[model samples]
Target chain A: MPTKKGTASGGTRRTPATGSRAANQRADAQRNRAKILAGTVTAISRNPDASVADIAAEAGVGRVTLYGHFQNRAELIEAALMDSLERGEDVLSEVPLDGEAAAAFQRLVASSWVLVDQSRALLAAAQKELPAARIRELHENAEARMRGLLLRGQREGAFRVDLPVSWLLTTTHVVMNGASEEVRIGRLDPEDAPRFIDAILLPAFTQKRDR
Target chain B: MPTKKGTASGGTRRTPATGSRAANQRADAQRNRAKILAGTVTAISRNPDASVADIAAEAGVGRVTLYGHFQNRAELIEAALMDSLERGEDVLSEVPLDGEAAAAFQRLVASSWVLVDQSRALLAAAQKELPAARIRELHENAEARMRGLLLRGQREGAFRVDLPVSWLLTTTHVVMNGASEEVRIGRLDPEDAPRFIDAILLPAFTQKRDR
Candidate 1:
């Protein structure tokens, strides 16, 4: 079957040749957008107070192009934070949730370790740059997802029901935040961080079972 | 009887004394000590950069007297941190560990609320005024106690067994550190603070129950 040709003149219509070229341009633009965003995030992570000019310089994009992608500072920061969270969420989602509750809990703690370890600077910048209202909004979304998973585990009798799901989620953050600080200061060997996690988180989340 | 004669000299020790009496003198000195400490703590909380002279003025003591109590800025700040941690430990110790695990957990979380709350200013000063090595030393002591409680709870079959107790204990600080920033800016309600504690801590520590 022959494809319909573009309508001429009055309306803007693209021929198949033009459409294919447009798709390639769109893909190239998307790649550029990703690079600019990544560059901005890295700059801000390095310096919480980094300006748009600095970000543009790092990305090798003009100020106009940077603004074209992000309308303002808050918008740029928000996008960066969202991107980081999305990455963290992807990691957490992939963690195997099946097993004894204790085992599952360990996986959860370990996953947090990975997230915090990787995103320490970015997370710190988010904490510094975002307003509390925005931070709370972001936190609430994460908390909801975490609580749902934990509650399911609890309901399945793999996790404890006595403690509130919210608390457990907060506790996970606390462990990672504290451990990250230690790692940053060289007080903790990065490789040994998991042991620190095990010593405290394992005991807190695990149920007593005969060895 | 012989009481009047006893009161003449030796009995003066037990009696409530006034004016230039030794007991009155001791009481006045004790009050002065407390006033100075309270003043220093308040000033430091508001601005850790406050000088010893400023702290003395706030405490209603002479600069010389402030120096008499603390050798220098480092000593004063260290003492203040220690005092804060001591109060924190006292609060944790007061939680009834012997009660039902859930009830005990609730009490612990509630008690911890104030500790977490007070830590904002303390941590800010710590980040600025204290060395990382010094902070780690303090954290180690605090973690030791927290770890014991978590282990005890696990052994009692009250807590889950998967995550590390160390991770749970450290994460409590992260939640506080993260949440305190929100609370300070009024973006998060102070009353709702407990929900944060409940969300992460309870799940991390409690065992899966039938409920």
Candidate 2:
């Protein structure tokens, strides 16, 4: 190997090969970082007070590797929280905001439920670990998206115009959160959550006479 | 004191007087206990990890007095949680369950919101400190009452019959919890919470054409 390296360094071809290996290493590092982030979400969600070693174990990475990726618990938690929110936003983005307001609202609710359910542990951990201000900031994007959709629904006459869009958005958010808890506790069937949510929420947003 | 004891030993009338004084003392103790319980709810709600001294201060009692009433933090938390549930039940009982299903449901929601709003901190604390089974036990009465109301509403054709009563009950519980959070976070106006709850929930439980 030493003799081959000495010869290879003298050739122009070695530089490109070394560069490609470095690129591959960087990609592997990025993939590992993402896996650690996902693992942190699950670990923290299951136990809000989980240790870094616990998270590393859940992530299937070495403790040293996890520490190398995240300098501290706070940094790792922040990353996990952001990761959850971003995934939730991705789910929301898949929903067509401009379609029939009621139908779109239902789609949004159903799709968002999947994200909400997956991130329950993360949400619980964040509430316990993060400050109110930070939690609010993390929630702002989801709130804005909801508010915009609600207002659009109201404007299109799919939702009640008399009620403030903020109220509608707040109600939907709360119901969804509550529903998730119900499902978690075995009070509501997880399979039926979307329908349960729509049955309860669709009426709230739609016109009184239409229901 | 020696003279009084000698005189009391000689007099039959002193026995009744002493008994009355003892009764008064017991009544005063009961009143103080109630105050402490109420105060603990407020203190714990404001700060989930509130200390015994902090709760005693909120209750306007001495730390020693608080300890005399509740031997430890766990006992005090149990009492606070029970007190909240009892108060909520009282509110539910006041709303006549036999009246028109929709009207009764609205009254139940309005009355329950007041209790729910007041106990947010206690609920949060309970979730963190108490076991899931204990939390379920504490919530049973409220759940039963809501289930009854939903069933009654569906029977009367006041609400959509297609949805299960359990689903309806779960939805109502979650929405109320969510609404409480919204109020807690200052996103929804506290003074308007009951009305807002009614506006959103009435439709969910009631038939669309009926509205």
Candidate 3:
């Protein structure tokens, strides 16, 4: 995460004052773009069909400034999705995954559930606007992180070896999203989600008695 | 599973020959309606957006005859879904549940998965034309059947009791639907699904070591 300014504008600067002004303008543009993306995430999370004007108002910027950063609604939603995933990656990468594989997996679930709950609506919005394959491509890093952990858990004998690791991974996600729906329909309490997730998953991944 | 003919036309009989002719006509109407419903299932399963003409051709009936049974597409899809669920109920009620819980549960999954795989697309089509609550209402028998098995399994200590039975049932569906997608993507073999489902669910429902 280093910021590298474009060199296209760098070559035209001459006086020190002009260069300093250009740097300040670049910083302003960068901040506006970040605000618009962040605002898009919040607006869409609250309402998937949120209008562009709502996003601009949420970001406290003009509609022109919003369009200046993103060419259209799809571009804005995609960038918002990317922003949310990057934030998720930052959080998921820091969870301590060093204990027993089961414990580590639950911890991962506990941390990731909140992120998934927040981003799932936005993800659905993105699906309506983008190709399904592109959506899957954007999700590669997060999927790999979770898939790697499931593989490790299975190999260490902490997870069931009778089922394929891919199946395990797929069901794990399904369980989380199921909880999201449960909460949506008022069948489950949101505050109790992490514990509910762990309760279902920890037992689910353990060895089968028949084996 | 007994057939109840309408009493509206029951009292309109006159002479013996006329009564016989009326009964034959009733039987013919019943047969044609059954064919249309069966044809709708096949047509929708093959293509959810299948038209009235497609369904009529599949059922080998004329459009007028098809309309004679169903007032419109929504009514037809609803009838088709009911037909499927009733067929499923017939098969499921015969699955022996007198054995150990885990074995019985697997037996249930193996039998129901085929019905689900065949009817899911048709269900999706029903969902589009029908209210969601109505759709859920239509699925009550299937859900109740599965829920009863899970409850018995948990009560007998053959299935994990750490999670709520409702959560267990919801995730059971998610896993089945997940497998469908996996098969659709060509990642898993279609013939291997039952074994795959049993492998996932048996391990998933076993008690955890910590508990």
Model number with the top TM-score: 2
- Could you list the chain B TM-scores for each candidate? 0.72, 0.75, 0.84
Model 1 chain A worst lDDT window (10 residues): A1-10
The recovered share of true contacts, given per candidate in order, is 0.39, 0.90, 0.52
Q: Which residue pairs in candidate 3 have backbone atoms (N, alpha carbon, C) closer than 3 angstroms, thus clashing?
A: none
Task: Give TM-scores for every candidate, taking all chains together and pairing residue i with residue i.
Answer: 0.53, 0.77, 0.71
State the lDDT of candidate 3 residue by residue for A1-211, as single tens digits. Answer: 2345643345544687687778778877987888888788788878877889999998889999999998888899889888888888999999988878888888888888988878877876786666556777787887898888888988888888877887778778777877886776677788978887777677667775654
The superposed Cα distance between candidate 3 and the true structure at residue B18, in angstroms, equals: 16
Interface root-mean-square deviation, candidate 2: 1.7
Q: Rank the candidates by TM-score, best first.
A: 2, 3, 1
lDDT of 3 by residue, B1-211 (tens): 2346533244554886677678778887987898899889889878878999999999989999999989999999999998889898999889997788888888888888888777777876885677656877888987898899999989988888877888788778777877776776577777878887777677667765654
> DockQ numbers for every candidate?
0.20, 0.56, 0.36
Docking class of 1: incorrect
Supply the DockQ value of model 2.
0.56
Q: Pick the winner on lDDT between candidates 1 and 2.
A: 2
Candidate 3 chain B: 10-residue stretch with minimal lDDT: B1-10
Output the better candidate (1/3) by DockQ: 3
For each candidate in turn, the interface RMSD (Å) is: 5.4, 1.7, 2.5
lDDT values for all models: 0.67, 0.78, 0.80
